[model samples]
Target: MLHGIDLRLPRGRWTAVVGPNGAGKTTLLKALAHLLPHEGSVRLLGREAAAWRPRERARALAWLGQAEAGAEDLLARDVVMLGRLPHQDWLGVPSPADHAAVDAAMSETQCQAWRDRALGQLSGGERQRVLLARALAVGAPLLLMDEPLAHLDPPHQADWIALVRRHVARGGTAVSVLHEISLALQADDVLVLQAGRLLHHGPSRDPATHRALEAVFDHRIAVHAVGSQFVALPQLQLGSDSNSLATSPSED
Candidate 1:
């Protein structure tokens, strides 16, 4: 349902997409990846999206969806290896490079410990890490992840952030849909969407981006600087007056 949208993602950087529920964040990601049908043309790597062959597109763009269903029967390692499909010959066995990629991804996500287990047997957080590893195994320059932090503990979520930072530093581009405003603000840039429209796209530190974020959420949250980071705090409306209930000590 997005309208009149035109975006140019910066190369070799991370962009976080944020908005309230049903704001077309997920739909935007899907359209960018060409996973769903859309009216306007989507160009990837400066080429028309539809013109790229399926395998070529798959190798260029890796996807991790929100709570994807029905891979429970597969072993964790096997699931991650699926990301190597684009590089392997049809019906061929996994190559050394493929195995290496899978191993490295699992290790990066700290899921190698349970690589032998089936997806159905793991905890929510564990499965999330495995799926994250799967996405990483793709080794695509552009990654599109929807709600990648789901079910991760605080430590793992921090680890995810660090991983993304490293990916960008190493010259990869990534776009993610995130509900965690603090983490979203950590991204190099933030793209704000609302009611099927693009509200803002700019550096996360930009005051204008902060304003758009606050406005889109109906000012229920306040954005403030905490140390070197910008955080969104809830505003408790008390009659005619409003006060932030979650402001950090430093920002207070």
Candidate 2:
């Protein structure tokens, strides 16, 4: 059970959810998107999130899950086109509008060149871009992604970051659950979680935010400003001679 997760994501900005494993970061995103049931108020676009219709909610909020699972045998473009399912008729034929949206999504994610390739044949990074294209096809105002950078190369990961920036630049809102602290620092806002509770939620530049982030991951990690970016490094632990000798085997 997550307790005290009262976070407010600002409009037209990117917010990164950071925490150690089992910190409820994924759960928090799911709950905010109404993909998971939870207690407390969750307002999306000034409406109580729970009150929105399933179809309406889907078109208003897009979700890219950790695995992006489904019909792996499908072609990359077909998988991307699946994002249009929310807007299709009972027959689900792609309308001209649908095609335009799909084209735009593919172009934005840079997957247009690989549109005809089978999803299974794509590299891990390629598949992630395709999945992002699928999410963008929804054309939602709010996008929630869980580990969207999984299996991506540095260049593609940077591409994903740029895509997110473009989306938010165009009046979209995004919340992502990410483990990469360095990339997370690029977001406009940060939400730190620890043991199913909110550790801090505010602008990423706040000193308190950095301190709380450092504390939650333990003092072992330090957050420092490098140029205009904040990066985290793992601190080394020193062992005392007494403790080391105590574990030595007894002499025969």
lDDT of each: 0.91, 0.86
Taking the tens digit of each residue's C-alpha lDDT, what string does model 1 give over 17-47? Answer: 9998889999999999999999988999889
| lDDT score for candidate 2 against the true structure | 0.86
Give the Cα RMSD of candidate 1: 3.7
Error of 1 at 35 (Å): 0.6
Q: What is the alpha-carbon lDDT of model 1 when measured against the actual structure?
A: 0.91
Q: Which stretches of candidate 2 lie over 4 Å from their true place?
A: 239-252
Q: Which candidate is the best by lDDT?
A: 1
Can you write out model 2's per-residue Cα lDDT over 47-88, one digit (the tens) per residue? 999889988898999999998666768998899888998899
Residue 251 miss distance in model 2 (angstroms):
40
